[model samples]
Target: MNQTDTPDKSDLSSISQAAGKDNACGTNSGTHLSRRGFLKRSATASAGILIVPSFVVSGLGHTAPSDRLNIAGVGVGGRGFSVLQAMENDANIVALCDVDWRYAQRCFDHFPNARKYWDWRVMYEEMLNDIDAVVVATSDHTHAAVAAYAMSLGKHVYVEKPLTHTVYESRLLTRLAAEYRVATQMGNQGASDEGVNLMVEWIRNGEIGEVTHVEAFTDRPIWPQGINTPKDAMPVPDTLNWDLFIGPARMRPYHEIYTPWNFRGFWDFGTGALGDMACHIVHPAFKALELGYPDRVQGSSTLLLQDSAPMAQKVALFYPQRDSSFGRLPAVRLDWYDGGLQPLRPEGWPDGRNMNHRGGGVLFHGTKDTLVCGCYGADPWLLSGRVPSVPQHERRVATNHQLDWIRACKESPDSRTETKSAFHEAGPFNETVVMGVLAVRLQALNKELHWDGENMRFTNISADEELTIIMEEGFSITDGRPSFSRPRTEPINAQAFAEGLIRTQYRSGWSLPPMPA
Candidate 1:
């Protein structure tokens, strides 16, 4: 991963002033240092002055960890590797696990002392004493299993965005994290950027008037929909433990396409375009608007692939509860367009201003103005009128997401620079985006789902029943079901809504721990 470019010194200084600290950082107060003081001390500290110790010993601090934070990483490839690299400067990597040993082997070269495991469960049990935190960056299907297990052990966690494979898993994760009181952060690192926060502050201050609607779009295309394709099952490479790669995912014939990056488009392992992009694209707008559970969600999509395949393009609509803060505001409707799909622009915006980029982004339509921003959590550049200005505020931008998490792990939760990193704040955002994923999946099935957020089910009785039947049929209404089905032991946890379904199982001896009571 490329190093994050350093902002101008003047910009940093301005940010520090706005933050009211030498370090313009934000996190939960219990687990953070005074950013101002840290920056001040770092500036004068000599080469050998252990950075973390200087802050701790001086008590220029608050609550500090009794021991150094130990971190283990699962899925150390792609984004996972990036996160690991980011954390390397601040935390000790005690263990590394990946289904594809080859992928993780490269990472081990960097941390020669860390134990390596093909299965995360093995890492969890064997490295129990060596790890205080875990990073879960596996495929969407395995997110909940890894994270829930980690949190259950009272380990702090940093899971990738879109939280879980299904709404049920999302709820389970949130509950378990709360029960365990683990510090948690989703991998929507953009949430820590000053631009995203500025967008939130802008909306909170009504810069564009009360937001009534939002449009988010992504250019992601569906591919490698599943391993059921004609690709010949190849011999498992010696460097990779094929059985482990199928973790939590049902037993499947191994295909080369399923490995590396193509898994994101497959229903069995990933969330497709909606799940892959919505978390980053819609987060700022969702947070800025203080949007909560949607009253209803509906979706439409083009069936570009076979019934067994993931959808190529889709659109989802979320109708949120009315808010008095915006004055009898209309239910905020968020439109998500993915897989080269695009929403019709609001009536008055310039036609040509539409973004041509294939990546995803969000557009907020308020009473008096429209705001368009880049997809993938890029900073917002006012697309229309000047946003109402407020008093200058501090801009907290973390140089590294992993480092931020390490810093949080070392401090009490109350001292953290921002609370959003915690599951409470990140959960809702994940829920909202993942809901969009569920809606898209339903649309793919040509099912009309009328969601009742409070009830967390379709109000249409028949549809609700069909949903249960579908689940029984070995297909998850949120995430697609595996090619096979398991016996239904208990009624599906209707209350446990999940956008992605965890249908696959890990290789033998690599099962995730049961959800803690």
Candidate 2:
């Protein structure tokens, strides 16, 4: 694994070009921008311009303030309802779509003026002109299909955390967002927290010396395992659109236990503890240290009831890239613990052991000092003996993550802080944490896997083969393959095994846009 910390310049450039291309503006004419016109438009813009569009007094496809950024909510239940409530404060909620009619009915009651649809595709097709943004808070399985389609239609998106169900899906969504040139934000609201910003500055300024190791822990074993639960095929609920719910997954009989909250424990629907909490817990360390993918991930834990579910106590080791700008050290090691697991105390920190609480958070150990953080590592308090000269830092409470997103959407991109909520920053953080889920999957298969960060694959060929087989029986290729790797026999969807990218099957009239030429 070539764990080097340099962004692929070519890839960045392509992203820039994609973002610069003009979007299909009007509903009537999809043929407005010719190839030459697109090239001309792209040539006149700088990379910054790609993110911050110049105000055009008036032109074709130009969005009007009165258009009101028509918006839709894909899953308007629980957290989805919260997302809808947040969006209501900013943009018009023109449509509400959900597989559960009950959820949709509740949302409809809240926004009586908005159109309601049990299917997202119907909502999009019928109200395409009315919608300019989409909020996708559906189950992991349905994320890719809805988000991909929304992006294809030139709509801005705010998808919930863990950005995608699988690695392939994450990269796919990122690519489509760039290609569509629409403003995007992931659901990792802590990315904009003041405390997280302070943590990054402290680490960058060497307040904790050269950070060689980090440990993040979470208590996410609340969901019961589905193992040994008799596969009693029950009739689909009257309010549930079962087929739409199963959008891309291989079909399975309906079970009440698998719906709503319980989906997190199932391999076919969710990525378990790491996927559920990694995005929140790992953000502070990843952003502060500027770490990329890990070189090798090894995990050890007690298997819970479900064979496919993540273990109760798990630890993932991340070996940082040698060329990373975050530190001058040759390499760094990061440990992630969850399900009540705790990190071993550092050599001299008196209160290190005291910081071992349940829930989720991160611990940083440096050559000279240590620091412990809370709220999924988004908030931190320095704890060490070597910091006599260091100044005391205050932590800020982030009352609302959604407000941060709304504020960014309403403000100029350049005016926003570097720590502003952004997919570029948030996406990588998600990738790092979700790796723990992948590690759990590998551990379940009883394979010791070595990762090649530059190649984004296992260094051991046999291990790689085993990973491919376990991911999708025979599917080997991944859409997110690093530029330097050899192509796999299968496509990206096959590589996204448990991410649930392929879990939900769309209804008759719904389909993802064909991959762009």
Candidate 3:
């Protein structure tokens, strides 16, 4: 992990006028202060030599820090840029931080007045006093690291979906949020959608009858997968800080094939299709049926790559019977498909009708009727074409996902609003999502793998069974195509292998804070 990134000197031109300008929080704009400068300022204020702004002390007639949050964005490129834009109306944009300045230039241009930093750690250190919340939209591998550090400092965090790269990190972040007692939300915007609420309400009203099984599918992996690691070393771009992008993952040579949007296909950086889409597609099933954790998980995929996810895969998660408010819900099975796969279409379904025009959907096979919805739980309906009218019991949010989080951050202690995908819920839910990823990685077990959710391990596995997988790898380009390798076996420990993947190892200088005692 490289920690040598410094602030852009060109962005410091506004430091002289920072104190004169008023921000949305009704406080003076903040400048990037060095450690010595920050300490001196703190000492001066403590000695009562600094004049405090009226609004900082009280709201009076203006919006105070109490009314609006001072928000900073860590990966203000791509999705992070959009998240910050959505939040700009409600919060003060105090700072913008990103590892790659070239990619994040659009955000920098858009929020010109906001302080900019190349590294998030420096941003946090310099602007800790000014920032009230952080929006983290970094690669999946670093989500936990960035958010955990922010939460440790009592900063509210909104992280992008597929919360963490590993199941253990999900559990860690969830617990840390509670220990810190700060408002936190995962960036699964669909969780706050009207569609998810409707799906939950319909299921609660028993409109779907008893959901015997559920199937969710998506046409993801828009990026390349089922391939070997790129051996072609490329020069790191001048505008990018390559080490920061790698974060906690082991350092690898820079390659265009691994960056921008393509990281989703890689194992070390992203969680492939399951992690990319399940959080959106399977959310309704989890919410509507209260699918907490699966007792058993199994998967099969196309040739498992050396350093990336397969091109396509299918995973089955078996849940045991659990008591619910209505009664003991029957044990259910959820089958997930990605990379252009779909479940056997429902019987008697019209061929002319598309399953989901959006290329992804969820199907709840109830004893009486089959309920289905598109991506993000949109347009939920029954296959019988007779959707029942259920009284809406779920709270509806008029604001978008980002604003909902902002609203929660501004909530007074007397009345706190929990964001739809608050970490307490999103964390456990993410553990389930990444478990599917784990099953994909360990498909070599070649049997239905038993999962002990409470213990966070796979039970019923024997050491007698060798853990080597037969992989047909393509490492070189031959005649304009990838040359293939014959099936080869590599030995591995089935039990320890599963455990190691569950809890990812961090490179030095990038460790998660220990769970609070």
Candidate 4:
């Protein structure tokens, strides 16, 4: 990773000055830091980490574990609680923030000294200067907003995966981390697994020859989806901030389906099965294959619903040839199966061996042999032989994932504290996974969606223009060119497509922090 990428003036100019829409929590009283000139100041403030990390108390030669960071937590419920537990031992956790106090209370109890807030915007505003780092483990939709604001405050961030709800948001965070020179780590723990490095070594050493295809699957959607919204609104629980829970998504009446662990199935609120699990299954495949973006993507599902994801869906993405030591690699096709779906059993497996364990697994089919492993890249081995001996190049994590990021924030930069899943790699890897989410959304059309990764536009938008795609519900994409003049390359404006999907529109007062141009 490049340690230097100062934000340009133009990037600063684009960030809106309007108080963000989500800062509605009334208790959010604190000094308002100026977003303008913020980037320049952050670059300078980062240098202060070396001078005095506030909480830093060093003895001879190096800082002790007791001299740790003052970190803040957003979404301290469920998985958010787990992340807090993982890092609390090493850091001075200063604040706990969550939308629902009921679910977030356990974490609050764990850290009696920590301040509490339901709105993360409030927490950041009230304690901006005091915090050395931020940890975001919110639902998929709000991840960008919270982390973006935290990074803007010059705090190192560790975001849970899949990093963002949209490809555009992932790209923004990737660029922002580098520009701020803030250490970042995505919460896909397997990126730090020694087994993942072993897999990378085997693939690079051609133990599996050239991988032509990969089939990864998970039995998720253990939540409700492909369903209608509640016909009537439920009374908002006094302990929950329904508006903040909805965050930047367009508002709707509060319902049980949208909260308390079921939100993963909703389109507006969560990222369904694909978003919830693929980041884990695809983590090692991404790093080992050196995948950036798929050249083409398509999907098929039971059906896509307006308010929720399909009951089941499978997406196939093709990544074309790229350079490798194995010489020119052929197009690698990856297929994702979900919601109790499983891929066809591979060839060359021993007569009675199971292809995968119960939860899910990833299989790499190469010309010479096949490799498989459980999720989070665990227990990887050859189909019927001892693990191949290959030289390892990537460094293994010394303690665990979360501690690595925590230590990297204060511990020596030259040491083993550097995280393997830093945003530079995780951002692009996650952007790749969310593409599958988009494909699953379009699966009802039963069409192959062509992607122009460089332009970040769906090349096949023209196909939809040329053919009438009618939904069973009633809406129709009619067969005709767009009224506005298209691009010269038989094109549509990339910026226009970007505005709606790659990054979505924030509700009235909310805006994502802009990245340097």
Candidate 5:
């Protein structure tokens, strides 16, 4: 909750390191860094990196194209560790932040120069000037909060796929990125693939006459789902910071079922299979075809659970043909099949050919040809082994995901320097994909939910009730903004919540000293 504007300029020498302690719940002295002494000089005393007042990069010392960025990371375990690893060639990891120490010990030991912390907020507060960028690899629900906080202070952010837990958070973060003009990238490596451009060229060249349908599939939810919520609470692990692990999520009792990875199955913690893999599986078609919002979306699934995703589910999305720079295209249907569900193989596809070449694939049915590719949009090819003369007109890159973002963070934006999956691109893609997931959530209501993506709400069903943003009281993104002190919209009373599904219960977690009544 110690959110505010970032210091105008950074002086790494002014920063002091905190003494080491094994683990603390973050209530008393051992909980965080020495905040008051983090920066020795007044914020106004230094000359900032930018001539312009805002939308500035944070690394004061590293200015050249070759200088390494002072990057900090939250959730530096699982996927987070790899993301940071990929950028190691260009980043000086100034700090490593994660809630689970046992899982994070590898990364901690790897980057001995980095100071470790249990909470991202404390890390950001104390190491404000030292970090030029933030890489967030937390759970789906916590993605937007951590990314938004870092971006608010003018740090470039690279968040893992799907962008945010809820549609609202995704939209808000998109706006924030544009407002801040900081380099932003969502973790969809396919956006950087040479194959994506190849596929786009094929579609644009009309080798595939006006793409009419898309069948995307993934065999996900390999984890537990469509099950009863665990009733028994377990003792919190000594190495895990339970409160910080919860982040902005509504507090729940410690349970093995929710941590060390399985959270993807839970509605509150992960995006199930759709959120987990669809960003990669569905992205090529989405980007090549320039799909924005869907006209409407609906779904069918095995018994839907309030606490977890269905064991198997399929979301069907309808999109009216929208004008694009390529050309006018016909209306299209994008069907997402997950939990091993798959669309009927298109009739024109050759007999004996596998519908899904890999565990996941995308099929674009066009009037002239059908294009297919694997999960990362790798090795795209037309049906019947037909290879059209696709002269490579689009720019090509070799494994440019993390490298592209790293470049964007330091260089000025131009044709070759822009991050391919910049928030604007990734936000809408995730928004459209998430709509299908949203449809699946209404299995009980069993009705097509028409979305108004521009308005960030549902038009027909008034699903605004479901769109409310809840957070632990002190954690609201609006925490430090005095202007929003009064409720602008009708305040929501939280019954409970999770990430990727609900507004986290935005109003809990505080042990503040008493104030004058």
Candidate 6:
């Protein structure tokens, strides 16, 4: 993974382009009626100058223009497309933007009335006054920049999971959401699920006693990782704007390996298996246990790579005891696994039965009993084969993640209903999740790195701590026997390396927008 000490200082204001020059599509009439125009006409009709249909005035059969949000979607080719589809019933899908038009064509076809654009900046430039909210599902590296710009405009935003690429970016978005007072939600769909709420209720009610340890695992990296960067550049797709796709990260030649879903494995573009899945898998634990931050973390992996994450990794995060209104909470340990790794099966599980419903699940070993939950915290059950029933504590919301955010967006700012995974909460949860990423990346440090969450620093190790980094061979069958290799070692300042990864440097012309005054 590449790390930079100082970020580029240039701001987005410096990147300018002509608006209305490259719009891909618009209304069927060949003339655009902006939201401002609709409001003006509605105002005129109220004065008896025009007669509006009863349905339009009362929103009996259709939503009134005044009652619907004009929403825009960025990176609408994949996950964003699904989000917009969910919001269509509640809001007006007014605009769609993506770097690759071919990839986003399906979304555009579904909402033919929504204007299309290759660049989000241009979409915002042309329709800033018309938009009420934004749905951002851009690549991990660009989530911060996109969400920050939207929040700065005071537009409610729904962003996809992992929340952000780096710890610094997650922290920045959390602050921006509050500063702008925008209703914000991160797309961890399971956060809104009844199963997750039940887990929280059960754990908080002490149905399982105190959770002493947790094992969260996933089968991810469904894409390539633990390999050297592709050396040869591939031709850029005709419909793709490569520069826009690279947003905020250092520019590189276009390659099929880095886009359309494969980016998850690359450090610069994505956050690997942990970031992709942990937001859903660990959310229940974070909520039920009030896991604020881990004081110490350590990790081991199949093989650490320079340009990407390892194929498999096991990370342990240690949290300190805490005092709460109900009582004092004991310190807990969280172990995370990914890339085809899983925790041991509960003792009473059938010999040949699967450990988890799918490739991932969470196991909570408490003082009194053990509980296990499937991915997304679904299908939780105690070791004795019973789903705990506890008093409902968490307020439930719309089961659809995007719809929940839409409800939050429509709320009055002064009395907003917080989304289940609001930025303020998801942001901190994300920081905790990505700390495992940091541990995995710095596995060579081979030290239990102590963290100071509030200060965003490592407390135990000095920046100048020198050490010999060694690479161990991964396990494989060779001629029906074990294999080995002479380990390669290098000397470096380990603590400094760990610190650089906590944050990331932005490429020129791609800084996160500053908070609004």
Best by lDDT: 3
Please list the residue runs of candidate 5 whose C-alpha ends up more than 4 Å from where it truly belongs after superposition: 1-17, 20-25, 28-62, 413-416, 462-505, 509-517
Candidate 3 lDDT over residue span 1-517, tens digit each = 1112322433322222234421111111222223334445444543445523322332212434347778889888789999999988777897988777777888988887888776676566667668878999888998998888777766789999889999999988999787666678888888888889988988888887898799999989798888777778998776666777887899999998987878999989999999988988998888778878899999889888657899999999988998876677989999999988998898967778888646589999998889889988888888888868878878898989889887777654335668899988899899999999988888877788888887788887786655775454645787898776656567877777788789988876556667654
* lDDT by residue for model 1 (116-202), tens: 555565455445455778988988878887887666555789999768766657767777766655567899777777767777767
Candidate 2 lDDT over 1-517, as tens digits, reads 0101111322211111123432222111221222234333333332324322211111112443333446788887757778778667656887777766555566767887776555565455556566767888888767777887676665667888767676656656766655655567777766667667678777777888888788878777678642433358988665665666766665678888777777777766777777777777777877777787777777666643332464565656666555556445545677777666777765665753555443677888877668777755544766654333434353343445655444334433344322244666665556566566667655544655566644445555341332332221122456965333222234223234332322234444334444343
Clashing pairs for predicted structure model 4, backbone only: 21-509, 487-491
Look at candidate 3 and tell me the lDDT of residue 163. 92
- Please list the C-alpha lDDT of all candidates, in the order they appear: 0.61, 0.59, 0.78, 0.73, 0.71, 0.76
- Each candidate's number of clashing pairs is 44, 13, 0, 2, 16, 1
- Top candidate by TM-score: 3
lDDT of 6 by residue, 193-240 (tens): 888888888888888899879999998878888876677899876566
Candidate 1 at 119: error in angstroms? 1.3
For model 5, residues 148-241, the per-residue Cα lDDT tens digits are 7566667889999878777767776777677667788999888788778889888888888878789898878778887766778998765666
lDDT of 4 by residue, 76-185 (tens): 88888898788877788988777776777778778877877656665655576668888888888899988876776667899998799998889889887766667789
In candidate 6 the C-alpha lDDT for residue 93 amounts to 96
Q: What TM-score, computed on C-alpha atoms, does each candidate reach?
A: 0.74, 0.73, 0.86, 0.82, 0.82, 0.83
Give the CA lDDT, 0 to 100, for residue 281 in model 3.
90
Q: What is every candidate's alpha-carbon RMSD to the true fold?
A: 14.0, 13.2, 6.9, 9.6, 10.8, 9.7
Query: Sort by lDDT, best first: what order?
Result: 3, 6, 4, 5, 1, 2
- Candidate 6 — which pairs collide? 1-306
- Whichever of 3 and 4 has more TM-score, that candidate is 3
lDDT of the structure predicted as candidate 4: 0.73
State the local distance difference test value for candidate 3. 0.78
